[model samples]
Target: MARLAMAMQQEKKHQHVEAPDGGWGWVVVVSLFISSALVFGLLRSLGVFFVEFVRYFGESAQAVSWITSIGVAVQQLLSPLGTAACSAYGSRRVVMIGGFLSALGFILASQATTLTHLYLTMGLISGSGWALVFTPTIASVMQYFNKRRSLAMGLGFTGVGLSSFAFSPLFQFLVQLYGWRGALLILGGLSLNIIVSGALIRPLGPTKVIERTKAKSLSDKYRSFFSHTCEYFELSLLLHRGFLTYSLAVTFINAGYFIPYVHLVAHSRLVGFNEFQAAFVISSTGVTDIVGRVVSGWASDLRHMRSLHLLTIWSALVGLFLLLLPLCSTQGNYVGLQLVSMAYGFCAGALTPLVFSVVPEIVGKERMVGALGLLQLIESFGGLLGAPLSGWLRDLSGSYILSFVVAGGFLIMGSIIITTLPHFCSCTNPPPLSPKDTKNEFTEEERLKQVLSLDSTENIHNTDRIPETLLSQNHITLEEIPLSAKRTDDDADC
Candidate 1:
């Protein structure tokens, strides 16, 4: 009893210290920047190699399209497992193991003579590795900051755009110089840098301090397993109205999101643009995409603006710009295509960071690990099939025009759905605070901070909504904890 009490007290003391949001957290941001570069950069630019595979394998367009789709599917599908592993083990161990697997998969892929062999090595193995690295790294960024979370994520994710710009031309050059196999070998070497990124992951969230205890009976063990699984997966978040609607919007947004990345260059080629001009359109998108991410993030942080409104605006614009792609193709001017590409890129980049940033607000950050995992798990289906859907449309229509239109339609639908967020859903919730009450008002983040400031036993049951005072003495898991623990008893504790 004495030892357990002391351990609990120490744990309480440690969590009270606010996250060092700007200090070593910046180092984690840098690490995530490199990671986003490698993961998204590679995924985005795989189109440069799409033509080569079609030529060499004599495969149909849809058949060739499944290669990248399978990788994306595997990456998104396994995000829950990645979160569970990060929860059980530390982020560093899982990510380093992931890095090794990624490198090994690519190295093996470089020697593959069959498409199935590419699917297994490159799609399954390397994609699973990406899951392990991506889930925990982004979760850590959300955990490490409150006020500046969007800005931090914006800075970190800018790597994707910057890297997409560099890698498109670089992969084209590598393919020109040494063939696809040589390019895969060099990329295999580059994927190992995730190990260095993994090294920089320092666990930043709530501390899990276990007491010395004995094993349990069979029934008890099974119960423990189920409990831990729920904790890891956060199935309870399905109960939150805000989270459900936002996740649904994400599903639609994701259904349309990656189409341009996968098909824009090929679309340019179909429109009579030369190799450099086609790649240049993608590169221009990358540059403005970087600018949009930073600017949108900074805007979302302003006093009166709601992040959801900004998110809705950006998503609507992503769809509108994608709809303009076919029109740009019709124009057949290099500068016109580049301008349209930049417009599409800017909106897409603007919404990407807000996608993750708004989740902590929807569900309290306390339940984020499971909520985020589930969000990705559900969104994986969209990521998996969106490209193939485009390819299938391409085969039928004999042009990429119909495909871009379908993609744009889904994004526009997503924009409509996000307007149902809490701030807009009901008459009760106000849109913004006046400058006078803003200081006195408590945002959800502040409310959570106040709850966490309580002693651990008391804090456990009061995560949501503001509490007038601590009202319970019991320590329980999140599933059992109420939004407020208000009680009638005044002197229940000594």
Candidate 2:
């Protein structure tokens, strides 16, 4: 009791409450928003320049696409490595360095005269930079909040939507005015915003102490590295119930998520809409995505909702929207497009943070960084495969009807898989018990009585019936003790 009291005192003395808002935390959010805008938001607009790049390079669409695809692939593949670096060093330095590299990659790509040069500069280097910037930004935010985490994440992710709205027109204007080379140069300069943002992400409160405590001996570090690396490369997620369900669900949902973005403009043209109308359809998604992210986060916090349930419900709605999209092919169908865009955007936006939030829930915060990295790697494969497959299906058939149908089918399947999660219905509830039914079967009071009984019979301590005042003074609760003197053992027998 004395030792426990001492420990509690020490913890209280060392612990600090981070400013729930304002201070360095807000600075980190701003920095992350900028970085996110550069990476994810910029990536969202890549299709805007895809055709131009294909023509300029005199390459097939498939070949030119490899540039963007490889960049995405590298970003996804190196996510765990980036997470490991953040865990070892700090988020601030990692993000700063990543920003520099990313900007440098774009600048170099602007000078590239060959496809190979573009691949090396834009794909590999820029991709790595993005991975570094993104992973740490997420980690830094997670470190800042516990109760308001979902809201914080929502605000941070809103950058993507905001950036899409701002950057798409900007990029198109720049490409038209200055050509691809000059546009790359301008965008490269813009990437420096990431560095400035990264610099602002200082550690908050006791997070520094926690990071220091995580440092291990050399051999222990090596063992930990090997274990994590194995986990990263392994397909063992298929064997883990929670991971399997998450991965499969996400795969299905993502198949639908990107297809709309990829084909929206083309579909608009097909339906006899002007280029601006098509762009408007894509941009509308961003507006709704921003709204969805913020609203969903706030709602999740208020409702104390499980992330999976929210994800499943939203994804199911998105599936329904996709099914309805192809039905409206006329000028009147623009309303349908708007509705589908908003619904899809809402579902995808909400699902992003909710998915990451669940990582900490499943494996605990200690392993969360690693888990997120692995999950990104898997999901990236889905992103890479889904869009092109949809495009190919469109080409093989005369229309996008079958393509969208397949995409909607995948979304529904994903939603169903997500709904099957054990804790989807009850975020606060413990998992189901096994045949023994002993792990989580007892009430707190019952457990306390059992402990008190055990202690009384063994006479483990010199003191008996320690008063509530003593327990309170020592920061111990009555629940910690089991009394043996109780007549009925029914509570303890389980």
Candidate 3:
């Protein structure tokens, strides 16, 4: 008990303090809104360049698919590094550097003479920027709000929809006015605004700067370095059941999540829609997507249902719509395609905020950054394979029907996996603070009892009761025990 309390006191010195839940958080949200517009919003709109890339490069769809896939892969695969950077330097510095890298990648890609050049410049370089930008920005937002977290996330992500609504057609126009190369150059210029967004992130709590201390030996120095790295990245989360299950479920969801963004425009053209018509289809969905995000955020904050429940419902709807996309195309119904795409857009947008909001539920707010880093690291595989597989299916079948079907399958599988989350089957949404407070109390009591039991073999299984005499002898009090014991039995005592 004394050790736990001592550890808790030491932890407070370096903790990533929770957000005040308001005030400058709104400014951070505005920053998030802009960052989302640049990152994901631009990503989804890049599909406007897909067919152009195929025609210009004369590469197979599968080969061309590697462009976006590699970018998404690198972004996710390197997220742990980004989080570590944020822990060492503040998120502001790391994100600004990311913005510069992102713009540089786009500018360099403007000069690409071959597909491999695109892969290196756009895929790796631009992806590295995204890796730096994404996890830190989301973690910043989570640090800012609590009860209103869903709404805050929803409002922030609406930038994706807002940008998509404008960017799809705007990108197509840029392509026509100047070639794809020129268009990419202009994108590089626009991405510089992300640096401004990064500038706006005033970290809500303690500055994340780590204090350096001299070590007695080289081995001690290495051990201290490893310890700091583990602490900053929360490597312990790897052993957490709830976090692991959530990561796996999100991985499957991610496998299907981006198919529409990457392929929908191309599929529209394949179904005989003209260029503007196809662009409009994406733009229209973007409008609905905005509505969905705002509504989802508002609804989630109502606290009438668990965020996990809302996420499952949204995931299922998104999968159902993905399945419908192919059906509408097979029937040669452009109107049906547009409507189904809009429906898919709404459900997908609605789920975005919930995706981040649910993290605090799985892991407490203090661990949000590391948990997000690990989650992105694990889910990167899905992001890596999703689009390329869809493109490959398109090449083999000469249509996108099977691609949509397979993507939907992945989403449905994700929905099923999420049902395995702890407390997912519970009927009522427990008041947030009550359960946490009660659980903390229960855990410390039980842990102290176990220690007492361990001290005396006669009381081995008598964990339900703590002898008062032993407590007096040990100079322990229940109130003095640290609530850090509020972790699952599967967790390490530390």
Candidate 4:
């Protein structure tokens, strides 16, 4: 069992799929860009439909809010399943199926007659598709880059900002031309493009062989499947202290992170801004969001500081801006609100890529897919409650002021939590892997060659004089060698 474990670890250590840092990675980045836009970019713009749903269905704000909240929550909660599927099937097939599901949801949603229908179609179905599309795409991008990972993530996610800028007004225009139902049909068509993007995702690592056996009982097959899933999903990561703390911090951030995207338009209208003006506010923020992502990505790649430091600063600023957003409505000051919203947009965008980028640093790239999936799954609680909580506050108080304040508080709490991460105060980059960490880095073939060369040497009499470093490199302790393999002086004389 120990040998088997060591062999598996050695395979991971020696044959790591080296990040190209560029090359076909650039293509993966492009696919990430497209999928991100269709998924989150479209999601961010869905606020344009918030008022329409409220008025059309005559539902309370809190009730209508559940539509988006359910979708967000469902997408996040199912993320682990998506990553698991990516691990079993290739990412390409899983993502393509997800794309189809996403489009099917929208197309089916067009004929909905009730909010429940919307919840089932848009919230459940499309959200499931999003679950499959996001984690794998992000994981693929991470695998294809090393030093420039932050920048690649930033560039890929720029699609969200750009589409947010474009999709808001475009959605409004579509809603104006065709009722909400007709607009959904068009959106469904747009979602089909996610299928094409899925096709562009090339696997970064060699495919693992699917274990198989002769006929077995049904229970045996089920047990085997569960065992395979547990190994592939890296379920033990749940016990990792650093990962848990990081996930907790991110969950708090998630609680506040999406409040604006879901409510900013409604808040604008409440402050006496017209629909176009409200839409423009979100669109303008999207523009700054793009700038922030690019700038943050470029600066992170410069290696002047830790990505955690940048994330901490941006998270704090994002909370600060969220707090200030409510103040902009004191006298219905559109300009002030818009400017504050843009600032919030920039901070939000800057921190997003860092959120994913820092995971590799925290857990190492080998566990990225599982880490991302688990992170999303844990944070889904925040996403599940955030918007609806904000909406309930709005309903209770008849204003969004308290809601924004509470949202900001969640972000601030997240920022404080981030300060406790291991090595946050370090002044220098982390040291390279120690010998203990790299015990399996040497290849089996190299160890065999070294053994043969040592045996061929005429002057060497025994393994006692073998270099400790060489033994350590080969992950073999002196005590583990058999007595029969070690030559005795008496035997040598004979």
Candidate 5:
């Protein structure tokens, strides 16, 4: 029994060291597809239900807006907690719990009699479940693939676009047939798919926990706990300069990124469009969004293109499309509206894949979970207020024009801010990968050859250029390992 246990442990360690870029990764991607399909896809299509709530509950647009706003805000705000749970217990366990809570939230919401009831069930309960599922699924998908990270993320997130396309119309049909209450009940049952998604997420093997010791003092135990906490939650990222800069830009971007999803359908109604026409607007965006995400995923993977650069371009384009929205609503005809919606959807979707990919390039993959959680926690403020503020503007001014323009302005500001990052200092230069980028695509034999071969030894320093005075973690110098010493080591391996 002892030998069997030891062998199992060794096998797990070996699998953990070897990147399984495909095999189970495709299963993980399918799980991500379903999770994304239900989570944000439903959220984006919630605009179809927005007007129903206003009329049923006798609330103003701004007051009713909190229904989705609170849900989105809660999801983002609690992401760190959810991520911490996933890190402590595998992703599958955390997400399964989330799936149950999510279904319960919808079940409770189906019986809601007041706006407050909706807030508790639909907002807090459902949002908490989303927080658990989202970060874990996304972070897990990234861990499975190194070479095709961008493409995997693109495919996983495209679920949002595909689901959004079908959901908007289907939600409208369901609401028409069964009313919002019955719709909620049916939606609750549909949300059970999250459990299957969660179950599909196999454990990534046990995380390396530090061994406890009887010899350690209480103070030592406390210090060790703090260290593990920092590693698990990546709290140290708060102090990282690169993280701070990128986060600041995303903060600005989030302030407006969700405005269209929440308000565009309502905006169409206000501008004299019928129910079908309004829903079609969202559907159109969903259609183009699919194309944008897939194409940009491939684009970001280009040998010469940087993810951050692609992000900048996409952000700028999204802003441009938002700025054109008011024109589409007022002076522009149906053709103009379609064109602008297509452009906006494509650009917005294009930006999604690059956002997460750029993080691994800036920080190492090991810190990805924490970095994503912290970013979500910080950006929750924007998600909390973005739609409500848009609703408030409409309440005050009786139009969405100024609101959309301001949203576009926020994105434009974000696009400009990201350019000031260390990599963007020069338009022609790609920002060098961080010193800790341990992503090596080389097979075991190739790695052995590189480590042992005496030819082109300088290439061991992977980054563009580094001075001898500043030796990075991955860098090896002649003074440290003379050729004579390397030859002796190589001969032993042979």
Candidate 6:
């Protein structure tokens, strides 16, 4: 395993191409944009329908909440499988199938009258579709860009915010006008955009080249497949020092990340704000999220510091703001929340790209698809449990204060873990070169010239050109070469 990793690293060092930004790449970006917007936007807007679903079904808040939560959990947990399918069959196929599933799920959901049906159609099918769509999209993006990868990924993920902003109100309007069934049907129809977007994404690189290099013989292919499968299940990442640290830190960070977003509206109401004011706080957070993503992308590219370090610092600051959140329960508190929200949004925006970026650096580009899949699979557990756990704390304590405090504590722990990463301080240093003695050795031409001189048993000395201090210090003797041999020596030097 170590040998394979080393070989993969060496291959990556020499083989990477600086990504081209225009043409088909732009087409893929546009496709990804539409796809991301549709998938994430639809997911985010579930809260809009949450209350209606609860009242209509006569279910408890926790029961109806499972509809969206289960869907999200399914999407996240299935990421590795979806990614593997993409690797085996092709991203194009996976995405197309995913789109179909998403549309079908939503349509099936429209006919549902019971929780079981909703779970099958919305939670299982739609969630699986999301897993298929999201995993492949990220893998494809990595294949497309190198230098501009973070920026591109940031831009692409902004589709989530775009969709949330545009669709939330539209979905609300649809629910008001056409009942939940009609609204779901409309959403199902709109979900076809995934299929169209999937169609737009042709395979990005030399698929033949990848296949040829990775699997030469049938036996080799079988072995490779088995090995990959094993790696996936074992999560070799747990053994990697940097990856383990990052994973643990991120788990803690994520444990707190969603709390503010989840409770922003309720928190606003608690402070005596009207519904419109509460709604505006959510809207403002989304708007700021857009701005934050863009700015963070630019900063990540332009700044000299390591992106992970920047992300860690920002995350810590965001956590600190969360710690201060409980103190603001008045009108002054609402204003404070908005400021913190914007700051947190900006930091969180930057943190997303950084989160995925480190995987490629830690593992190699070759293994990136698998690594990212596994990473998300693990982190999804954090996402799945974070908010509800916070809510549980709220239930236990009769206040959101302790929950926020716990969230802050987790974020701080995450920051500390991130600070311990080896690469955090090594970004300024170039990679260590091999043939260690080469650091102080003469040039190849000079070495060759010296070796050539040994054949004639003559030392070619140019005391005039050589530094006098070095010759004196070494107390070396110089021998003169014949004029005929000097020309030969010059030719050899050339």
Clashes of each: 0, 7, 0, 0, 0, 0
Q: What overall lDDT, based on C-alpha atoms, would model 3 receive against the true structure?
A: 0.80
Total backbone collisions, model 3 = 0
Question: Each candidate: what lDDT?
Answer: 0.74, 0.66, 0.80, 0.80, 0.75, 0.64
Output the better candidate (4/5) by lDDT. Answer: 4
Q: All candidates' TM-scores?
A: 0.84, 0.76, 0.85, 0.84, 0.82, 0.76
- Candidate 2 backbone clash number: 7
Q: Distance (Å) between predicted and true CA of 469, model 6?
A: 56
Question: Residue 299 in candidate 5 has what lDDT?
Answer: 80
Alpha-carbon shift of residue 59 in model 2 (angstroms): 4.3
**Pairs with backbone N, CA or C atoms under 3 Å apart (clashes), candidate 3:** none
Q: After superposition, how far is residue 408 of candidate 4 from its true place, in Å?
A: 0.9
lDDT per residue (tens digit) for residues 1-494 in model 2:
45433433443343333435445666777777888889988877766666567678886544555566667667777877777676556688888889988899889988988788888988899999998899778878776766777788888889988887777677767888998888888888999889898888876433322422432221122223333333333222233467767876786776567667666566666677765676777688888888888887887777566766776787887787778787765555788777777777777677777767666665444345566777777777766666666666766775667677777888899889877765676757355233243222223223443433422232224233232111211222234443211111010000
Clashing pairs in 4: none
lDDT of 4: 0.80
lDDT of 4 by residue, 216-293 (tens): 221122223333454456554565667889999999999999999999999999989899999998899899999999
> Candidate 5 local accuracy as lDDT?
0.75
Off by over 4 Å in 4: 1-15, 210-226, 432-494
User: Residue by residue across 1-494, what tens digits does model 3's lDDT show?
Assistant: 45434433443434434456789989889988998899899988989999999999999988888899898889899898898788667789889999999999999999999999999988999999988898889888877777798999999999999999999999999999999999999999999999999999886434434322211121122223434455566665665678899999999999999988899999999988899999988898899999999999999999898889999999998998998888876656888988999999999999988988898777665567788888999999999999999999999999999999999999989999999998899866434444445455334434544433433333312322323222212123345442232322111100
Q: Tell me the tens digit of each residue's lDDT in model 1 across 1-494.
A: 34433433443443344555688889889888988888887888888888788888888777778888888888888988888777666677888888888888889989989899888988999999988988788887776777888898999999988988888888889988999999999999999999999999787533231211211211122223333444456654555567888888998899899888888888898889876777777788888889988988888776356777788889999999899888877857777788888999989999999999877666655566667778888888888888899999998998899999999999999999999777665423253333343223223323433333532232323233212211111112223443322221111110
Candidate 1 matches the true fold with a TM-score of: 0.84
